[model samples]
Target: MNQQHPSMEVMCHVHNCKFNENDYCFAPKLEVNPLQGSGASNSKEALCTTFQPR
Candidate 1:
């Protein structure tokens, strides 16, 4: 069986990010990882691994 996921808005503030268009993320896929290998304790400690420099 195939599953379909609902689309949602992804807001971005990094003007230099390649996938950022009009303050929104347009990447085909989004990847978020912990800033450190250990783990993220808060939102600030997490990082967008899918970020690409424009």
Candidate 2:
């Protein structure tokens, strides 16, 4: 199957994440969600659901 990478770079600071490489996210695909409410009002409210422990 063909795989497509995102044109934009995804920065990550979670060192324990399997997809984190040099502070950058390398996951083939990523998922994010709000910690609460219908939408996130700020970055603090946004959660990285794609994180997986290395």
Candidate 3:
């Protein structure tokens, strides 16, 4: 499959993640979302909503 935004660089720092490589994600696509309840106090309120285990 082709990456949705191959030219766009999305960095990842979660070393334990399977799709992470050198602080970047290797998935064909990525989806980021805010955690439920709708109020975000900080970056921690957000989530990598599309991350999947290897």
Q: What is the lDDT of residue 22 in candidate 3?
A: 86
Tens digits of per-residue lDDT for model 1 on 1-54?
A: 899976989999999999999999999999899987879889999999889999
- Write down the lDDT of every candidate, Cα atoms only: 0.93, 0.92, 0.79
Q: Report the Cα lDDT for candidate 1.
A: 0.93
Model 3 spans with C-alpha error above 4 angstroms:
1-6, 38-41
TM-score for each of the candidates: 0.83, 0.80, 0.65
Poorest stretch of ten by lDDT in candidate 2: 4-13
What are the per-residue Cα lDDT tens digits for candidate 3 across 1-54?
A: 976634788898777778888888887778777797866778999899767665
TM-score of decoy 3: 0.65
Kindly list the per-residue Cα lDDT of model 2 for residues 1-54, writing each as its tens digit.
Answer: 999766878999999999999999999888889999779999899999999999
When sorted by lDDT, best at the front, the candidate numbers are 1, 2, 3
Candidate 2, residue 9: the lDDT equals 89
lDDT of 2 at 30: 87
